[model samples]
Target: MSRARSVRSPRPLLGAATVVAAVATAGSLFLSLGLGLTPCRLCWYQRILMYPLVVVVGVAAIEERSGVARTVLPLSVFGLALAAYHSWLQVTQTTCSVGVVSCATVQYRLFGLLTIPNLSLLAFLLVTGIVAVASWRTRR
Candidate 1:
């Protein structure tokens, strides 16, 4: 008599990142479209960095490819930096010497503390953390 061995595959990190990215994307979209909020230049830059992540991670997850996680690090790092800078701009307000839709504009605030850029910063940090964890685990 022979016993069959069951195989267990590790969870794909990309899937986890993809789920988070999806939620982030949807949330931002809702805030902009549903709430009729205009995104400033900084906000648009953050969106540019985040929007592709949703598709990239989602595809990698569907294909069960871990390489993408490692590859996405640069983007995540830059995104984190941009989000941080954008958040700082809102806090400092620097007189916003520019015209309309200045980067320092904070359209709405959650709990009177978390501005849109602050939320973006949080989201980028989350993505960066998740991607780093996934990459580290994949190597181990």
Candidate 2:
């Protein structure tokens, strides 16, 4: 009896995801630089989590390492959590009274309703979801 062998590679999904992340990161950086909008401390923290994802996902895509998926997914999840909280604080207009930085003073609403932190939150969720889905589809 002969056994069937798989013919597909997982590199495409990883590569695509990486590209998406990198583009989004670049866009965010451009928005910060091109526009005069300064990032708050929490925004910086979220960036710390997001920037690495571009490299990690790119490398993993090229290498096609199973272990990379496992590791990267968790990091993305952490980023998602941070971004979500930051968004919530901004949208709610709640003050970070205890912290050195004030969330309330950060100008939560942008373009009338969309907040800067809200953008970060959405990006985090999208990136994390993509990574999770791609990782799950990856071959062992």
Judging by TM-score against the true structure, name the best candidate. Answer: 1
The Cα error of candidate 2 at residue 134, in Å, is 2.0
Model 2 Cα lDDT, one tens digit per residue, 7-62? 23456767777876787688678767877566677777777877888898888878
lDDT of 1 by residue, 1-140 (tens): 22221111113566677777787788889998999987777777778889899888777667656567666778778888998988888788765644458888778888988988888888788878877776565556
Candidate 2: where are CA atoms >4 Å away? 1-8, 97-101, 105-113
TM-scores for every predicted model: 0.84, 0.77
Q: What is the C-alpha lDDT of each candidate?
A: 0.75, 0.70
- Model 2 vs truth, CA RMSD: 3.9
Model 2 quality (TM-score): 0.77
Model 2 lDDT, residue 119, Cα: 69
Best by lDDT: 1
Itemize residue pairs with steric clashes in candidate 1: none
